[model samples]
Structures are given as structure tokens and as C-alpha cells.
Target: MPLSEHEQRMLDQIEQALYAEDPKFANTVRQTNPAVHYKRSIVQASVGFVVGISLLMGGMILQQVIVGVIGFIVMLACLLWGLNAWRRVAVGGEAAAQSQTKGAEPKQRRRQQRPGMMNRFEERWRRRQEGDDR
Candidate 1:
């Protein structure tokens, strides 16, 4: 359900109060965009992957099985991390761009209508905990 104008105003007031109470935290949260962070992570992972490949080849030529295996593992990990970051960047960036073009009315409605995966998981966890307490 969309918030009524009165409720929206109240929520805005509460947000303003929160920012006033902790300007630093509010600034940090507002300033950081997850898509940008994900892109940076992808770059770092690419560099790590290249290093891992060099280490793996060097270790193999040097006849050190342990070193080679470790290098291979590191390379695999970096590749996986890079792929995950790329996925996040693509999804988040696209969603952000789409939202800007379409405007906030539909976006807010969609957000309000659907509970996120984390919210559902948290709800289940809370129920389990309550059951355990009893």
C-alpha cells in the first residue's frame, strides 16, 4: 500500500530527524552507491585473477605441486568473485537507470507491494526463534 500524504510527511519528518541526530551516518549511507562499489570490486578481482594465473604457471614450472594447487584455487575464487560483482553491477545499475527514467511513483508502489527476500528470511528466522523460546 502506498503511504497517504500525511503518512509520507510523517515519514519524511522522521527521516529528517534521523539525519539531524546522526549526520555522518546519513551522509555515508546517502553518498555510497552499491553499483559503483560493485564495479570497483570487479576491477580488483580482475587484477587478483591475473596475479593468480601468473603464480599458478610459475609454480607449475618450478615443480611445486602445493603452490600450483593453491594458485589455481585462488584464481578460481577470484574469477567467481569477479563474476558475482559483475552480476550485481549489471542488475543494480540497470534498475537504478530504469527507475530514474520511469519516475518514483511506480517504483515506490512496486517496492511497497513486494516484500524483499531478506525480509521474508528474517520473518521466518524470527518465527523459529520465538518457537524455540516456547
Candidate 2:
């Protein structure tokens, strides 16, 4: 729902107060975006993968099995992290695109197709509450 004019004014006042008290924080918060976080995560994971490769190579040269194992673990972790970040970015963009498209599916159907963890929990909680009410 759209905010009322009074609510908008109140929100504006709150925003102004925040900016005046800590402009740096307000600016940072405003600039921070989900896409930015995902991009950073993917970049960091790629860097970590390179470091893992170096570690593995160094371990092999030094004949240290432990270091090699550690490097392998690090590489696996980075690969998973990068893939997860990519998935999040893709899903978020896809959802927005889907929402904007003409002849979009009903919200109920779309939601049922992909019930997230929180959604499942909420459903369970609602059922329990209804049971208690009876």
C-alpha cells in the first residue's frame, strides 16, 4: 500500500534526522544494495579460489598433506560460496523480471511454486495457532 501524506512526512523527518545525526551512515545505508553484496561475495570468492590454488601448489612442493587438504577445503568452500551468491543474484533478478512481465502468474501460484524457509515456518506456525484457536 502507498503511504499516507502524513506518514510520508513522518518518514521524511526520520530520514532527515538520521542524515543530520550521521550523514556517513545514512549515505552508506542508502548506497548498499543486495546486488552489490552478491557481486562483492562472488569477487571475494574468486580471489579466495586463487589463494587456495596457490596454497595447494605450495603444499605439493613442500610435501605437506595437511596444507594440501586445507587448500582443497578452501577451494571447495569458495566455489560453493560463489555459486550461492550467483544463484541469489540470478533468482532476485529473475523474480523482478517475472513480476514486470505481462500476463504474470498469480501471486498464490508463484508463491506456492517456491515456498522459502521462512514461508514454510510461517505456515506451520499459522496452522498451530489455528489448531489452538479451535
By TM-score, the best candidate is 2
Pairs in clash, predicted candidate 1: none
lDDT of 2 at 39: 91
Model 2 residue runs over 4 Å out of place are: 1-13, 93-134
In order of appearance, the predictions have TM-scores of 0.57, 0.58
**Residue 88, candidate 1: how far off, in angstroms?**
1.5
Q: Each candidate's lDDT (Cα)?
A: 0.88, 0.89
In terms of lDDT, the best-performing candidate is 2
lDDT minimum window of 10 residues, candidate 2: 96-105
Candidate 2: give the clashing pairs. Answer: none
